[model samples]
Target: MRILIHDYPGYAFPVELARALAHRGHVVCHVHFSATIGPKGTLARMPDDPETLEFLAIGISGTYRKYSLLHRFLQERAYARRLEQAVRAFSPEVVISNAQPDIQARLLATCQDMGIPLVHWLQDLYSTAIGNILKRKCWLLGALAGAWYRHVEKRLISGCAQVVCISDAFASEMKDWGIPDSHVVRIDNWAPLADIPVMDQDNPWSGQYGLAGVDVVLYAGTLGWKHNPALLENLALALKERPKTRLVVASEGLGASWLAERKVEQGLDNLVLLPYQPEESFAAMLASAKVLLAILEPDASAYSAPSKILSYLCAGRPVVVSFPPENHSAQLLSGARAGIVCSSGDDAGFIAAVKDLLDKPENAADLAINGRMYAERHFRIDEIVCAFERVLNHA
Candidate 1:
């Protein structure tokens, strides 16, 4: 099979998918566009491969142009020519897109022209009805981008030959959008638990970063709009009385200033922010931590998903989720007995839950084992990648 995967959550998903497909004797090609092309934007290099899969990335600079009537027209014209030509030349047997609506629509149309199957990997729900209502009040340019995103999103999903949604809740919303049941399949995010290293005394991060002789609760990922920093601040303040416990947040280029402001205002001495570390260092931090903190914005009830949950589980650390129960994140954590799931805005409950783990380190270890068992049984990267391979082959 000749597979082409569009970039969605950066190189992580694509790299996992590509490696799996290649191992199964399939030729894979991964294509991604530069997320940020200017000084304000940072670029991540897609590593090189000599065989099996070819990786192509393009850097383009244009904010979502919802309000700027002129910019919207320009984007439509530019992508129409550039992307159409690229898809035509790649001529993949199955074109799997990361659901950036317009690009998906173009690939669907182009593949239809060439008699190829088009698959849209639906990672999140972005609708005019919901996302627009929430973020519509952005600055003049941002507002424009918001409106443009709504339009492109609708057209793209509606045209795909198939949709690979990450959860049942997400699939249900796709049905609401008029995507046919036959065209959708549920495939959750996955990680290689086996790939994570075990913690030992000699590890660099074991006793470093103020983690030595402290009760460390780690949150590792992008600290963006999806994460409620206010909750983190509150958690920090609540833990201030626990002199030995520290909340260390490690991420890069995600609302750092916002976190800093809340930390200052709340006077959270236990809250520490660190820049992103390399993959090994990150794994070390996760393994060394006594507990993992997984957070979701209070408003993320529309879709129950978070990519970071599996990563935490794979690290074999007990999780403390700040999300609502009926939501997917909470359900997954509770089902695995991985950790405690706290109600949104339940400061008392959150505090009590953390205290329970701190007071019962043995129970915390058991919870962490449950999480690792779940990851090995269900969320293993090899299992998920193999499932994705079947999707591509059958497409």
Candidate 2:
């Protein structure tokens, strides 16, 4: 069957998923926006890509990620046109829409007119996110905009042949939006396991980064605004007493820059800031970590689940997540016994969790084994793509 996988640009998972489908002997067209104008990611800088699948590149200048009124509407309208034109040209057997709810909502009518089946893959709660963004400036405007978004989101969700959510909580949100449970398929996020194998702490990659003997408290992905930058600084301060322990951040963004400044201000000699590494060293970087960190501000946890956590699991490293226990990330880690979960507000709890792994070195290796086993069962790329293909074919 011919399939179109519409994923936001720069996300590696979608590219891997598209390749898997193409390898299965299906004609696949992967649609993406201009990565150069948006956030930096592995897919954007990929030295090479597969020739098997068709790439529908939509040239978008100026990032649509901004919250400005003019930019949002203009970008949405422009992308809607791009998507319509691309779909008209490709004529795929099925359409799997990923991110950008506003653009996808506009295409729903077009898909109906063309007799094409639409499957919406819910990676995040875009409507709720818009509501949060707007409410930060004006309450009444936020409410009105949120209601409008909900109305359109319902139309998009109900119209789709299938609704694929990245987490159980997101799938539950679809039911709240009046989509039946039968229509929702919950597929947790996954990592490209082939490229990121578990490595030993004593590997040469650790020595390359001067991490041979240092105990690295690593935050290895984009340190975005939604993640409280102050928390990382606080963790650094907490670890100051341990001369051999250091906080290693391999990321570049607003939050990362803030942490770097804090390192200077607070005289945090243990803080090590570096630019994002190439994908080839990603596994070794994680392996070098004594304990990995994944954090989300309390308010943003409901609408988002950082895909980086899945990659951390693949590296077979002990993870320390500062999220609410009720949240999906916390639940997954706690269920697998792969890491420690400390509520975002509990500084003492977070500190103790980190210190425990340091004090009792055996816990680190145990969590690493548990994490790798959990990853093998759930995050294998072949299994994730096979599940996605089944949903598309059945839809």
Candidate 3:
């Protein structure tokens, strides 16, 4: 089967998914669009042309402002044009996108005209209320932008042939937005296991961050605006009494620069901020950590699921997560008995939970074993990739 996979957000998960499908013998043509003009992900340059598959590349430019005249127009023209062209050129049996709703709507029309099936892979939700609140602070025309997003969302979701969500949390969010049960399905996210050599190598982070002798409590991912930066400071302060412990945050995105400032302001002598590491390095660092930290803010909607949990499990490390108990991340950790979940707003509870994990090394070790086993059985990329191939062939 010929498949065209589209993901403009430039995140790692979507790119990995595209490659997985290609590995399964699908003639996959991957299309990536960026809101800013510059070299971003390395995967953007990778091609399937050596195989039976094809590859397409396109770039779109706009300021980060969500509904600015420039951003919306770029989305309407350049991004949508890339989607339309990829579908036309690939002559795909199936078209897959990771939540480019507005662009997806445009492609759906083009696909219907060309008699091609459209499939949407939703990793998260952009609810009218939540998305507006997120970008409204930065958008120049607040009310108009909010209305425009809501309208676009409705049009896109209504037209897709199938919407594949990464979790029940996202699936429920789509249903709440009025997409029928028949139109939406759940397919959890997967990342391939990294090839990290098991050997004694100098810590990639030991010298610069003063992590020489301390055991790390790590958080590895993009440190975006969505994260409460102050929480890191608070964690630092709480761990201050434990001199052997260090909170090491390896992150990318806007919040990264602020990490140094917050560390100074909070007198976080034990907090270390490392630039985002490559995939192999990330796996090594996570595997070395004493504990992993995953957090979600209280206002985060049903899309609060983060891929960090998978990394922690895949790394065979115990995790301490902060999110609502009913949220998918919390549910997964609790069901696996792999981590501790604290209410998103409970600062004291979160701190205490962290200390409990620190105090009980034996319990933490047990959780680590459980986490690795769960990841192997349920979230292994090879297994999930095979499942995706079956779906595409049958769809």
The numbered model that scores best in lDDT is: 2
Clashing pairs in 3: none
Model 2 per-residue lDDT at 387: 89
Q: Give the C-alpha lDDT of model 2.
A: 0.80
Candidate 1 off by > 4 Å:
34-50, 61-86, 128-154, 206-208, 264-267
- List, residue by residue over 81-114, the lDDT tens digit for candidate 1: 5666767777778888774455566667788888
Query: Candidate order by lDDT, highest to lowest?
Result: 2, 1, 3
lDDT of 1 at 4: 78
State the lDDT of candidate 3 residue by residue for 1-395, as single tens digits: 78887776555556666667777777777777654332123454345423754446675564545435566656557668766876787788888776455666788789889887777777655544446454547654555666677678767777777788878767776887799887776788754444322222136545445565567788877565346766777888899999888888887555667878878887888887877675545566775578889887765645557777876787777898778788777888899888888888788888887788888989988998888778778866677777667656555
Indicate the residue-level lDDT of 101 in model 2: 72
Task: Provide the TM-score for each candidate, comma-separated.
Answer: 0.83, 0.90, 0.84
Q: Between prediction 1 and prediction 2, which has the larger TM-score?
A: 2
List runs of model 2 lying over 4 Å from the truth. Answer: 36-51, 63-73, 202-205
| Candidate 2 lDDT by residue in tens digits, 124-193 | 7877766776787898887888788878887888999999988889987887888988788988877777
